[model samples]
Target: MRTLAATAAALTALLTVLAGTTGTAAAAGPTPLAPADLTGSVAVTGISLSWRQPAGGPAVASFRVYEGGAVVRRTATTSAPMQYLGVNTTHTYTVTAVSSNGVESPPSAPFTGTTWTLGMAPQCDEPAPLTVFDVTSSALSVRWSVGRASPQLALTVNGRDYGIVPGTSLRVGGLTPDTAYTIALRRANCDPRTAPVGYATTRTLPGATNATAAPRNLATTARTDRSVGLTWPAPSDGSYVHQYAVYDGAYRVATTWTPSATVTGLFHGTVHRFTVAALDVAGNESEHSPVLSLSTAACPVLPPSPSRVTATAVTASTLRLDWTLESTAGSYTVLDGDSAVATVTDPGAVLTGLAPASPHSLRVVGSLPGCPDTPASAPLTVTTLPGPTDRPVAPLGFRVAQPTVVNTYDADVPLSWTPLPGLAYRLYDGATVVGTYPGNAVTLRTRGAERHQYRLTAVNANGDESPPTAPVDVITPFLVAP
Candidate 1:
């Protein structure tokens, strides 16, 4: 019994020694070494693996490629090309060498390869070809092609299969406007377990109508002695209206891009009628809107006070004022802080030589020949924009320095930049001003693992701002380590 046990132990030791051999010997022909530098190149639906034979290895009889411990291919050469793989799939493989006596070496390191994704994957025919030829608000036309003739095929829309479609082309209707859809083509008797032969995605067009209807809510917005200001809503037919036509009875007086227009050069003490119509981008004209009728003021009538007064700063040292009157044939005066700054015959006046970054109160007064001047309109205060000259320059060398941890989820990010004399700074996160600092540095508190962009602008005493500096990005960590 002892002799028999010794013989079995010696046999196990011999097998262990053979298994541990790394070099291939010509005399004994032990198991060869694993192939080295095993690498893979992937195609649309395939992967090819290549390797170099290890040094000191015996002449290889064949090479085996293993996937998940199963031999998938055996090739006599150092390279193997595989086909018919799943699209956009990742596959891992290892290579091994086989000796002439049917001895297999250990597997090489794993190599991962991914097949081509959508867009690069081979389309229709081999995969099936589907095309969307026409798209409408509620319908679309689709055509498909196959390499071989099949008696019947199926059309699947959004996972619902319609069995046994007759031809390669189909007109699908009853779709919702501005909706997305997924379409596929398959064999009529295709197995539920397999993928479709062809698939595509598309969106239906939005609903629209012809702009042939008249505009609504026509009215007079302002009135003057010789002119009428009119306004109306655009046609509500989901069509783009690029221009409008103002009409006086049968005559076209003016064309404008806005919904409002003013007609001038009319006689005082006269009755006038005005109407508006909309024009689409395709130059299609809509029916005329309802008419608005009013009479202009006579010569001896007292001028009415200006209404709807508005003042806007056009530049650092200029402003524009507009107002409406019951009769516009009279003279008008614009007042700035109780001082007459302009006198004009029109409803709009531009005032120049004003101070930059300063606020002023404005109003308008109207008067006619042989009539008393009308009362001034309510005061409107407006501030001018920053001037072009003598403003601070943009910050120099702006950067986000190191961050100091505040807590588990918060940190204080330090920002530094070169300072300018007699100028304050405004720090902006995107378009929002986050802080105003008199010095060159500021610390901002942030939370989460988020990225933030910052820009710096210099502010002068008049509230004029310089051009913003280039933006810098900073990211904060989700957690702080002790």
Candidate 2:
């Protein structure tokens, strides 16, 4: 009887274990369907993954997202925002659906997605070209095609990057005038190779400062037949004056940095009204100053001086004086000492009857009708050639005059003689030849209270000397102050 009881207890324990196994097996739920139509889009910060709801399966309670082989996210909606993803990195994603009973479905085909950095480029259509217009000294206006608008797009100007607000056009300010700028359209997360670039220059604006006052005290400083010199006090505000403009009547004749200018190329003997104005660097000009009326002196005014005088073609009894004239309307007078030796209308003249080897002082004066002679030109001293030796003659009228005081301790004896044309005269002190001259007069220097004897001879062109003239004696006296 005890053995029978033991078999029954073992059978009951077996049945209890079978029933518990069957109950646990019944608690397991049905499999769900995989997500379908998986797709993704990239943004500057992250990527957005989306899928269509799976159909014809156990009721889906949620979705699971797998990156590579690891599960990364779980969501109840059809879209997933993968935030804080790595930039420029490819992420392999697959979606699976979970049932209400906690049963899971097989993952759908892998759907690859990528996230972009701030400057990372995406594989997409390029945006339209940017349009730039309304450029000014400190600002500019820009616009672009409407279809090209994107949150990741930005405008770069002169190395400064700017964000695009919600608008079709943008105005950039704080620019500089007359400066070149590089303008580019870039996507925040775009490839550098595809960034659209352009160039533009800003326009310069007129300055605000204007020269307020006219030049003061405009007056003529000098006047000539063809030119007038003018001067003025710089404008009280000199900083506004870039230059001074001088005007004759309505015509601008000169521009100068100082307060003075010369107006030239005017008609002689005519009256003119002159004025001055100040010009600023921005090209703004002040009002003209008070008028200055002046008349040029009449014609025959001292002609311009002659220049470049030269003695050429010298001979025993003649020489030619060549000079340059500033004007051709006047005649030239050749002078010896204070006397007029010859007159010529041309620039050249010849003086004849000059003693041989005689030094002569010559000058030229320009004369015009009804006008005083021009000042004599600078003197040109020249000597004539001696006569032929075969016909040499002694100087005549050789005499010595009374002594005259040369300085406090020196006296000069005046010697005079008749000069022969084309002959040089030699003066002697006692037996020694003291000096030679081509002229008729000479002075001998002597100490006070001295006695001197003088004689004269003539020299020919061939260097032959004539017989000496009779000797003349003179006694120099020292003067005593009373």
Candidate 3:
């Protein structure tokens, strides 16, 4: 049934384009109104135009025959009951329904078509448009071209109306899985105002075919605060997947086939979700599988919090003190051993109202109800870390970012800092000098390591160091962008 309809559609088209040129006498308007009903049979093949009984029109000066939209020949009054069309080929033709007044009705509709021999040029209307990429899943993305000259071409896939774009791509997404599609193209010429002639067809890409590879089951396991483990069904199928995409919910997390993927620095007791997608040689990704979610145990208990954080001296009306909190106790609680202080939720506490050179003391402690309480923080007794005497100009231009940490993939790192000449950088690994370099900039490259402790100190060539700057905590994941 589909083939029959296609034949009719093709015939109606070829005939319309060729017939308007019939009879040498141009019609004043659109198609000749009477030709449509003329009784006759026409067949098209690349080589010949065959017709049965061409003698019924008025006065018949001649019978004009068309093949594939081109005039093939004109036969005089006496050619027999039927004319013999040339060799095997796909062509469509129509005959003129003429009037005795040397006028011809519009040519008859086109007929069944056949293909021509190899030596003959193709009757295709335009240069074959290139078909670009093809991707299949529920969504298919493909690009192709129709003639650049025609603005009215419409493309149909499996007889379904696909919206057209001047450029070649059709992102046919949200389609059924494992289905085949046929594409067709059509265009019309307006000067003559005719139906389209160009047509073509191609099928959707194959998915999970007997010749294609299938997914192998994968296994995942939790590792230390650093990584996770990944395993997969060996390539028993004899085909290798280029890479695997790990998923956490709808977002993809990683691409690898490694039996063990050590995921690092995840929040304690928090569950992480994961799944795997495979990449084929064609760069097509496989559908994600069932999810793999796991929660990590909390990091090893942290050392007990440091004792008493306090504001020792009130110099320049500024109070200062120091203390500690248990690192691993979910959180911390502190008391301002300095003032008639109440216990504070945060680790640091400050006090006011003091005379210059006067002294004061503070008491502090760290506690986690569920865990062991640390020894009471010792009394914090000391003068304030000196206040600035004058406006000490910054020797080098520097930037202090708010919460200065940048997130990369799964990690956070400190903002980069640059120094001016005559200025030296002192990078610390906890009060210990890791670097003392003379330069305007320091670029740190920490490959995939998610969490780290870092701090920097700027010193002038005079050897006087600036007050200790706030420490920066960086957390990040492996894998830099390409």
lDDT of candidate 1 over 39-125, digit per residue (tens): 655664467676655545564555778898876765445556665464445779998887656577889988887665334433333
lDDT of 2 by residue, 1-25 (tens): 2235434443342211010111133
Q: Could you tell me which residue pairs clash in candidate 1? A: 124-128, 124-129, 125-128, 125-129, 224-328, 225-327, 225-328
368-452 per-residue lDDT for model 3 (tens digits): 4444555555555543323233221333343333232233322223345656556676665332355766765455544233233
* Model 3: residue 382 alpha-carbon error in angstroms: 3.5
Off by over 4 Å in 1: 1-388, 480-482
**How does candidate 2 score on lDDT?**
0.60
- Which is the better candidate, 1 or 3, if ranked by TM-score? 3
Q: Residue 77, candidate 3: how far off, in angstroms?
A: 95
Instruction: Name the top TM-score candidate.
Output: 3
Whichever of 2 and 3 has more TM-score, that candidate is: 3
TM-score of each: 0.23, 0.26, 0.28
Return the clash pairs for model 2, or none. Answer: 120-189, 356-422, 356-423, 357-438, 358-438, 387-461
How high a TM-score does candidate 1 get? 0.23
